[model samples]
Target: METTQPSGTTKRRVELRITRPTLTWFARPTVTIDGVGHPAQWGTGTWAVPDEGGTRIGVYLYNRVWRFGTATRTVTAADVSLVYRSGPLPVGAGRLDAA
Candidate 1:
């Protein structure tokens, strides 16, 4: 007799890439998916999302020197690549846009 594997055993992978502007300073960026945080170092990476949907992606930039200053953005399922640019103040010093 022949046996077949279950379809649910397969996993889907999503590729994520991030770029940072040259003028950013004293800020550390991180990417969050489904409330899980991942390093946002300038490069390429991969992540796994739920098969049934309902995934939230966010980019946060933390300013070490400033205690109350941080930048964050959360969105639904969308493009995987993002670009980080410099903003005006420390609270909004970093910005993430679809790349």
Candidate 2:
């Protein structure tokens, strides 16, 4: 899916980083921009405008233990880096936390 912004809207790049707790299992990270999922094998860098409400960004971490589960969060800034943690449970638990 493609997202279009209004004219004169300023766009900036934001970096999203996903990390796993020590001793945790493997996790596949995916970034959701305005509700659209984008598979991020390494990390995600995307353009967004803070004023535009369509700039809701999230990071989801999927693992074998938490099947069908993902940790999601919203980002609303530019030139900023957001971090999320993934694990079996008690860590993340399908919720994103700022690091």
Best by lDDT: 2
What TM-score, over all chains together, does every model reach? 0.57, 0.56
Model 2 TM-score on a 0 to 1 scale: 0.56
Query: Which candidate ranks first by TM-score, i.e. highest?
Result: 1
Mind giving the per-residue lDDT tens digits that candidate 1 earns over 20-94?
545456766677876778766766776665554456666666666653223345433565555555555544445
Per-residue error (Å), model 1, residue 61: 1.5
What RMSD value applies to candidate 2? Answer: 4.5
Q: Each prediction's Cα RMSD? A: 7.5, 4.5
Deviating ranges (above 4 Å) for candidate 1: 1-10, 66-99
Clashing pairs in 2: none
- Give residue 57's lDDT in candidate 2 (0 to 100): 67
For all candidates in order, the CA lDDT equals 0.57, 0.59
Superposition TM-score, candidate 1 onto the true structure: 0.57
